[model samples]
Target: MSADRSSGGGVSRRQLFGVLGAGAAGAVVGAAGGAGVALAATGGGTTDASGAAASVYPYFGAHQAGIVTPAQDRLHFAAFDVADALDREGLIGLLTEWTDAAARLSQGLEVAEGGAVGGSDYSPPTDTGEALGLPASGLTITFGFGPGLFTDESGADRFGLSARRPAMLEPLPRFQGDALVPEMSGGDLCIQACADDPQVAVHAIRNLSRIAFGRASLRWSQLGFGRTSSTSTTQATPRNLFGFKDGTANVKAEETAIVDDHVWVHASDEPAWLAGGSYLVARRIRMIIENWDRVQLGEQEMLVGRSKGEGAPLSGGTEFTEPDFDKTGATDAPLIDADAHVRLAHPTSNGGARMLRRGYNFVDGNDSLGRLDAGLFFLSFQRSPQQFIDVQTSLARDGLNEYLKHVGSAIFAVPGGVAEGEFVGQALFA
Candidate 1:
C-alpha cells in the first residue's frame, strides 16, 4: 500500500486505527489533530439528517478522526443482513449505497457520491495486520457478521427491503429465520460509534443514523457502545463483560506475517479507483463483567491466558510481554495449552492471521444497579472471515465463552481508496 492512503478511495493506513504514532515502535495511535482528515476539495460543508456532518471517516470521507483513545474517541462496529437480504448482489448494492450516502454526506465537497462497481471475482479478505502497524490507540472500524443474518420468519420483514413491513416481526433482527431478541448475535443493521466524549460520539452517530435511515429506508437498528475508562488503569489491557483482557494477543500492525497474504486482497488485483484503502467496522458485544468477577481468578486466567489484574500469561510474563508458549507450568503441568483463549488468540498459530483489537469500557445504568455496562464492542477487521472465524470459533467454546455472548454483528465490504475520482463502491448502487 502507498504511504498516504488518506488522500483517496478508502481510508489510508495512517488514518485508521492502531494508527501507529509517528515512530518505529509503531505503538497504536489515533487521529491526534486536524479538521477531520479532509478529502480533496470536491464540494462544500454538508449536513446530515440531524444536521451534523453527513458522514464520518472509515465509511464517509466527511471527517478524519484525529486520534484514538481509551476514553472512547470514535465509534467502532459492524452490521449484518438477515439471510433473505444479504445475498451476493444485495450485499453489493447495500455497501454501494452506503458509500454513495457517505459521498452525498460529503456533498461533492470531497468526492462525487458513488460511481463504480466491483467485479464478481475471487479475492482475499482485508489485512488487519496492517492496522496493528499503524498504532494501538486510535479510532478504527471493523465489520463481521454471524451466519444467521440471512434468515427471516413468516410475515417478518427481517430483510427490511420487503414491500410489506411485517407486523409479527416485533421490531427485531432475526437468526435462523426466527424472531430475534434485542440482543441478537448478528444484526441486520449494526452501528457502533466511539469518541472520547460519550456525548460527542452519540451526537455524531445520531446524525449519521438519520442519514442512513433516510437514504436506505432502513427501520430501527441495534446500537452498541464500547468505552475506554480513564477511571481505572490498574487493568493492564482493556476488557469486555467476560472480564477477560480481550484482544491482548492478536498481531500488531506493520508486523511481518503471512496472515496478511491470507487475509487481505492486494490493491494490484483490484480496480484502479481503489488503491491504498481498506474497509473497516466494529462490533460492541456487551459482557457481563460483574458475573465474570465472581469466577475464581485461576479459572479466569485459564480462559484469558493471563491474570486479570496484570494481563500477564497465566504461566508467567508481564502485560505486553511475550508469553512462554513452550513453558509447561510444572513437571507434569500443561502450562499454556493450545486451546487456551490467549494461546489461540496468540498470533503465532493459524497462519498468524491475528486481528488487531482496540476497544474501550462503557458504563451506563441507573444508580440502582451501581454497575457499569461494560463489554468490548469487540471491534476488528479482516480481508476475509474464514481465518478469523476459525480462531474465534475455537475460543467460543473455550472457558470464557459463557460469560460473554456474541450480541451484535455487522459486515461491510470496504473498497480500496483511489485518487482520480470518488471513494470506491459509491457509483454502482447509488
Candidate 2:
C-alpha cells in the first residue's frame, strides 16, 4: 500500500463539527456587510424570507440530510452497478471508505489531510483538487441500495443479502407512455449529491465515483440545475422548464407529523435494518417544451390547473390555497380540467399519500430533431414505493403527460443514517 493512504492523516469529526461553522466559513466571510461571519460560524443561523438556510447542514443525523434539507440549486445524481469481481466484503469496504469521504466532503474539507496537494508528489492525490477552495455550500451526499444490490437479474443472491431486501425494493412497473432506454435506468447503488454550487455537487460525485473505482461502475448519471421543488417551507417553490411553480403542495420539512407518516420508514415497519430509512424514486421526464411553448398560455394553465402568474388554482385563490376540483366556470364546466395535473397528483386523488419531492430541471443539449433535450429530473422520497406507484398510476390520465415522456426510472431502498463509528448501510451487512 502507498503512504498516500496508509499514513492516515485526516481531520477529525469533532474538529470538523465543533468549529463554529467551519464547513462554509470561507464563502460567507464578506457577505451581508460582514454578517457573513455569524452566518458561517453558526451553521447558517440567519435565514432569508424564504426560510432557506444560507449555509452548512450537518452530515450526521437521525435520517440522511439531503432528503429533508432545504433544496439546493444544483444536483449530480449517479447510480452504480457493483462489479462482478467484487464480493460482499469488498462492497462493505467501499461503503466504509465512502462514508468517511462523505463526512469530510460535507464539511468542506478534502477527502484526507494531504488532500489534493500536501501528499507526496509521487502518487496521485487522495482528493481531487477542483473543490479545493470551495465552501460546503450546503452539500449533502445521500446513499441508497437498489434492488440489484442484493440479487442479480437472474435472482441469484450475489452478496448473500437477498433475504434482507425490502419487499417494495423491486424494479418499478412500466407505466403508460414510458419510453425508457435500458442503459439510462436501474442500478445496484446510488448517490445523490446536492449543493448550491454546481462544481461542489459535481466534486462530490466525482470523488465518490473515484473511490468506487474497482468495486462498482457508474450505470447512469444526471446533472441538473435550478431546483424544481422546495423541501422546506423557508424555501420558495421553484419552477420547472415548463415555467409553472412546481411542488406547491409538496410535503415540507416543518411538517413533522406528515413527514413521519409519509416519508420515513417506521421502526414498526418490516426489515428492521431500514427502520429510519426511506424509499426513493427517480424519473427522467423529458418535456416536449417546443410543443408546450406553442400552446396558448391559458390552455397551459388549464392543463396545470393553476394561474400562470400566481400559480393560483384556476378555481380561484392564492398559490397556497387548496385547489377546488369541483368549482365550475361560466360555461358550467369545472374550472380545473378533469385531467389536470394538480387534480390527479393531489393527495386526495392518491389515497391521501404525499411524497417529499426534491427535483431539478435539466437541459442535456439537443436531440437529433433539433429539439432541446431538456426536461425535469424528478426525485421523491416516501415511506413505501406504493405511494409513488399510486400517484403515478393516477397520473395515467394527466393532461400534462401528453407533453411529457418518462425516459428513465429507478427505485432504491435508502437505509438509515450512519452512526459515528458505522459505515452507511452497516446494518444491512450485520
Candidate 3:
C-alpha cells in the first residue's frame, strides 16, 4: 500500500512503468513504522532461490507466464463479459490498463501508483489493500480471448475482430455426458490468476475485476486449491479430489520439443497473431463423491487404471513407468481395461494429442442433499482446440465418467505474451 510515484490521483501509462521499475527497489516498511522488511520478503525486488523474494515471477515475456511457469498451488479463474456499449478503442484501453496492472502485481507491487493509503483522502483507494504485506508468491496473471470477444452469439462482429479470430477459436462442441451449466460456460474474455498463497491469487482477481468496473463485468469465477497436476519435473505429481494421481504423463516444461510440438501454436498455423500462444480448455468436472466413496479400493483403482497409492499403471514399474496397454493378465484380459480412464485418454487412443494440464482440486461445500460439492477444475493448454477435442472424444465411454459430471466448460485463445512496453494481445489489435 505504499506510494511509488507522485502523490497524484491517477497514473498515466508512461508513469506506470516508472513506478514498476523503481517500486521493486524500495524497502517495504511496515505501516506502523516498525522495522523495514527485506526487499526479498516484501517486493522491493526479487532474488535467487536462496532468498524469500525468489517467488516473484516476471510478468512480461515472449510467452505468457502462467502456461509453463510451474503451476502454482492456488488459482482464481474468472470469465468476463465485455460491455456491449464499448467500442474497439475502449476495449484497447482496457487491455492496456490490464497489462500495466498485471506487470506491477506480478512483481509484488500495488496495482496503481498511490496504492491503498497514498491516494487522496476523499477518493477511494487505488488498491484494495488486502495483500499489503504479502510477497509475490510466484504470482502469474494470464489473459485469453473467448469466441464471443470477436463475434457475438448472434454471429454479429462486435469489434471488427471476427475477421481476425482464429479458425480454432470457436465454442467447444457438446460432448456426451456433459451436464454443463449455461451461466458458467462462456465469456468474452478470461483471466487465470495463480499464486502459492490463495490470498495473493484472490487479490489479483479482485483488483482486476475492480479495474474492469465499467468496460467489462465478471460473468463467473472459480476458486481452486491443491493443484492436481505438475507442469515441471521438479515438482511431484499432485492428486485430484478422487485421490488418484492426475496428469502423470502430462507434458513437462523441460520437454521443450513436446511443448513446441503440442503446446504452443506455430507460425505455420492460421491467425499468425497467436503463433507463440496456445489454446486453453477448461472443464469443471464435479465428482460424485458420495458414490465414489462407497466403491471398493480395488474397484477405484480399476476405474483409474493405476494403483491408488503409487499411481503406477497396472502394467507399470513405477509412477513414471509407461503403461503397457497391450499387457494382459492371467484371465486373458488386458491389465488396463479398454474403457479405463487412463487407457481411453492416452495419446495412443487420441492420435498423439497431448495436453499440458494444470488442474486443481476444489470443494465448494456440501449440497442440499448433503453431498460434497467437490471436483477437479480441469485446465489444459494445447497447440489447438482439436487436440483437446480428439482426446475428450476418445473418452466418451471412460469408466471414470460414471463417477464424474462435466458441470462447466469453456475454451479461449490465449495470445502470446506481453513484450516490454506493449499491452497483451497487441499483435491482434495492431
Candidate 4:
C-alpha cells in the first residue's frame, strides 16, 4: 500500500476513509462486492480492523495487476501501434510515463500535480476532470507487448526485440469459423484498464492515449460492462451475453497451485524476462443473439450442456459439479452432447489445458443490419499460447459456435510486474 508521491500528492487519509465507508455501505446494500470489497475490506484499503472506505492496489508488484486481481465491473481495453519514428528509448519513456500515471490512478489520484484545472488555462489540463471526485474503485491497469512490437507482418524486427521474443509470443493462428476483421486483430501494445466505474476505466485509457499521442496511436478499443467471469472464489459466477453462467471452472486467485501450473510461465519455458509472466489472448466474439433467442429452450440447454436456470450440468448436479461427460440419457446418447460448449471447452476434453478467463459482456449499439453488435470481450491469461489454441481447437466443433462469430483477435506477452523503480516490460528492452 505504498503511495506514489512523486506526482500528484498522495491520497489523503480522509479520502481513503471516505471511499471505504461508501464501499462498505454499498456492499451491505448489495450494490457492490468482488473487486470493490477486495479493495475496501482487505489491506489494500485504508480502513483499520473495523473497516472504513479506502481501497487501492499497489501499482508495482511481482505480477501485473488486473489478471489475478478480482475482476472489476467495467473494462476499457485498447491496443496501440507504436509510431514508426520512435526508437527504443522513446518507447521506454512512454512505458515509464504510463506506469507513473497508472500508479496515481489506482490510488484515486489525478495524473499529475495541479490535476485538471490545477494547470494554467493557457495550457492543456494535466488530468481529465471527469473522475475528479470519484474513489479509486479498485482500478487496475495492465500492460502487454504484442508480437507486432517485436516484428512486423513483413518479419522485419521493429525494436531490436526479435531475438528476445518468446516462442509463445507469435500471432495466433486463424481458427476454424473465425470471421476476424483485419483492423481489429493486432497491435504492438495493449493496455487493459478495469474499474468498478465505467467512467473511471474510460478516463484511465483516455489519458494514457493522450500521453501516447506522438509515440503510439490507438489501433482499436473496446468498452465492456458486467464481467462475465469471476477470478476469485469469493465472487459469484457471472453470465455472458447468452444469459448462462460462464467460467465456472475458471482458475481462481485462491488456487495457487492451479494458477502457477496453468497460468504463469516458468523460467525454462522461454525468454528469461517472462519467467513470472503469462500470455494473454483477446478475442471479440460477436454473439448472434437474435438467432440464439429463436432456438427452443431445451435445445439451448443441450447446446450449452447445462441447465439454463441453475447452470448445472445436464447429468444432474449443482453449478460447480464435476461434469460427467460419460453420463447417458434415455436414448443412450451422451447426456451432455459431444459438441456442447461446456463439454468441448472443458479441460478434460482438452488434455487438461486451462486458461484464466477474465472476460466481460459488451453491447456496441447496432450493426449495419440494425441488429445489436454485442458479444463477450474474451480475455484470458495462460502459461502458454498453445494452451488456448488447444482448447479453442476443441471448441471449433462445438454447437455453440453456430451462435457466435470471432470478429477480432490478438495475443500479447504480459511481462512480470515491475519493481518500485522499474517500468512494465522493462526486461524486454534490457
Q: Which number leads on TM-score?
A: 4
TM-score of 4: 0.90
Q: RMSD, each candidate, Å?
A: 14.9, 8.0, 8.5, 8.1
List pairs with backbone clashes in candidate 3.
24-44
Model 2 spans with C-alpha error above 4 angstroms = 1-54
lDDT of 2 by residue, 1-430 (tens): 1012232333355533432231110000001101121222112323344322235667766787688777788889988888777788778778888888898898888987788999898777888899988777778899999999989999999889999998889999989879998677998999999887788888998888777765677788888888888776666677888989999999877787888899999988979999889999999999998999999998999899999889999999999999989899899999999999999999999889899998888888888999988898999999999999999999999999899999989999998887786788888988
Decide which is better by lDDT, 1 or 2: 2
For each candidate in turn, the TM-score is 0.55, 0.89, 0.89, 0.90
Candidate 1 lDDT tens digits, 179-213: 22333333444444443333333333333333233
Residues 1-430 of candidate 4 have per-residue lDDT tens digits of: 1223343322345544543332210000011235433432122434233221234677777788888887878889988888777787777778888888888898889987788998888766789889999887778899999998888888988678899988778889889779998677888999999877788888998888777766677788888888888887878888887889888889988777888899988888789889788999999889999999899999999999999889999998999999999999899999999999999999988899999998888888888999988888899999999999999999888998899999989999999888887778887777
Evaluate residue 297 in candidate 2 and report its C-alpha lDDT on the 0 to 100 scale.
Answer: 92
Count of backbone collisions within predicted model 1: 75
- State the TM-score for model 3: 0.89
lDDT of 3 by residue, 316-372 (tens): 789999999999999989999988999998999988989999888888887899998
Q: Cα lDDT of model 3 overall? A: 0.81
